[model samples]
Target: MTEVGILGTGAYVPDRVVSNDEVGAAAAVDDAWVVRKTAIRERRWAAPEQATSDLAAAAGRAALESAGITADQLSVIVVATSTPDRPQPPTAAYVQHLLGASGAAAFDVNAVCSGEVFALASVEGILARSGGHALVIGADLYSRILNPADRRTVVLFGDGAGAMVLGSGRGARVRHISAHTFGELSGLIEVPAGGSRMPCDPAALEAGRQYFTMDGRAVRAFVEDQLPGLVKQFLHEAGVVPDDVRHFVPHQANGVMLDTVFEQLALSRAAMHLSLTRYGNTGAASIPITLDEAARAGAFRRGDLILLAGFGGGMSAGFALVEW
Candidate 1:
């Protein structure tokens, strides 16, 4: 069997930097309150003309360059995003066109913030059988769906995209990947009016049901009650112990919640990778963006164990183990 691994990684954030003060003012809070709550001072917002595909393409170009491959060499392109440019035509299709990856099979996966890991797991199987390179991208434009006056969701997200080029041979070899969804808790995080069930009609728009909404306390509790055990069980199933992991790249949901869960996991030797402080939560892009930053900074060594964990809307979670 050919070994599939991440050949290269890349990420891109918009140029417009939004400060806590700016976001807080709209949310009826202040900089201190925002910082004390999210540990985030600022985040990036996409330009008026920029869409999710634009950011994904930029990141994809960088990953291709880093991997020493051209866009035409890609056999698959999977974009994980909850915010598609439109309701029809998958976001990955636009990304594929932008990158000129004419031959690749392109699609989108929406597991909300856990989309990236889900896309990775999906692509791994495709590449394993097809024997070709693939590009997996996580991108979101949360700023568009956020309720500006709602502190709960508005101040916790930014616009960005992260990408990884996967192929058979050398790189960070993927060990195992797992995903779970708690459908009963799906309403914990949602945009209540956009889909078929609710349709974004005039009434829905007037009702403010189009905005992204989340039950913060419930989400925090879910993470606290479930993440650590999931991580432990995932590791055990993969035949690895917590001590064997050297790096943990998790969804940049909330700094405080992450701190609480980190201690519970007891990965004493592992260094938790974070980009939320500077990027807020980039939705599905969070984990890959953090991973790309760490990789560029020369953070991993050969034989090092890296864990990628993602959890969010759908009340879902995804985990992956990689050997560097």
Candidate 2:
């Protein structure tokens, strides 16, 4: 079997920096409260003209440059996003057009924040069989869907995109990938009115059902109950122990919740990579964005084990182990 690996990684957050004070003012919470809860001081927001595809394309270009590959070399372009540019066409189609990757198959995957890892898992098989490079991107424009006054959500999301180029070459060699979804808990996080279940009619708009919402308490409980055990099981299945892992790149969901899960996982030798302090939870973009930041910072050593984990709406969790 051909070995698939990350050829390059890249990320793009919007130029506009939104401070805690700005979001807090709308959510009726002070900076201190926001910081105490999420450890996020600021996050980026897309300009009115920018959409998810714009960010994804910018990041994709960067990743292709980093890989020393041209867009024409790509055989697949997969965008993992919850907030698509529109309902009809896939966001990846827009990204492919923007990048001039006309030869590649384009599509979108919506595993919510877990979409990146799920997309990675999907592309790995395609590229392994097809024998060409693939661009996997995770992007979101949460600022557009957020209810400004909903502190539980609006304060926790930002706009950004991250990408990775995969091929049979140097870089992080993917070792194992796995994903799970608990559909019974789907209501824990959701945007209630945009889909067929509840059309965005006048009444839905008036009810504020179009805005993103979450039961923060239940989500926290779900993560606390499931993530650690899942991580342990995944490592065991991957034939590695916690002590052997050197870096832990997880969804930049909540700093405090992550701290708790980090402790429970007992990966004592691994350093947790976090970008949420500056970017907040960037939906599906979190893991890849954080991974790109850490990689560019020279955080990994040759032959190091890096674990990537993402968990979010769809009540899903995805994990990937990479040998760096």
Candidate 3:
């Protein structure tokens, strides 16, 4: 069986950098409070005119350039985003058109923060069973959906995009991936309106239910309790042990969450790759963006073990181990 791997990787953040101090001024917290809570000193917010597709296109082009492939070479383009530019037309088609990838099939994935791992899993399935390359992009302009008045949610989200080219390969390739969801426990966090369950209406807008909300206490407890065991299960299932793993790229949820998981699992920062300090929690884009940055920083070699893990809304989690 031919193995699938990332041929190239790319990521893009908006030019505007909003320091924690800036956000604190609006949200009634200090910079140090934000930093201590999220480990985020700064984050990028999209310009008022910018949208998710714009960031995804930029990241896609960079991935294509790094892969030495043209837009025409892509067999598929999967965009994973929770915040789409329009509620109607899929963002993938818009991105595909902008990139001039006329022949490539395009669609969107909406697994929220677990989106990239899901996109990567989908790509692996397509490539292993067939023979084509895919450009998977995870982009989110989450700030658009945020309620600026809500300190808890708004402070944790930023806008960014990350992409990777996956194709059949021999070295430093994706090997095993899996996804699990606990939909029954989905109430930990979510945007109550804007979807079918509670369609956007004038009433919904007035109530301010359209913005993202989370039970911080619930989230903190869940991560502290469930995440470590989940990581162990994923690594063991992939036939790798904790000691064999080289880089632990987890969902950039927050520093507190990551620190809790690490401490519980007895894992060291030396075993992890992180970008939360600069990127905040970019939802689905977190893992890929972190992966791209780390690779550029000479974080891995061909035989190193790379573990991708995420736990997010829908009470969902995913993990994958790739040889790199």
Task: List residue ranges in candidate 1 displaced over 4 A.
Answer: none
Candidate 1, residue 302: how far the Cα is off, in Å: 1.0
CA RMSD of each candidate after superposition: 0.7, 0.7, 1.4
Candidate 1 to native Cα RMSD, angstroms: 0.7
Q: Poorest 10 consecutive residues of model 1 by lDDT?
A: 32-41
Question: lDDT tens string, model 1, 1-324?
Answer: 677999999999999999999987878998888888888889999999999999999999989998999999999999999999998799999999999999999999999999999999999988888779999999999999999999998889999999999999889999999999999999999999988899999999999999999999999999999998999899999999999999999999988788888999999999999999999999999998999999999999999999999999998999999998
Q: Cα miss at 306, model 3 (Å)?
A: 0.7
True-structure lDDT of candidate 3: 0.86
TM-score of each predicted structure versus truth: 0.99, 0.99, 0.96
**Count of backbone collisions in candidate 1:** 0
Candidate 1 vs candidate 3: the TM-score winner is 1
Which residue pairs show collisions in model 3? 302-324
What tens digits encode model 2's per-residue C-alpha lDDT throughout 32-122? 9999999998999999999999999999998999899999999999999999999969999999999999999999999999999999999
Global local distance difference test of model 1: 0.94
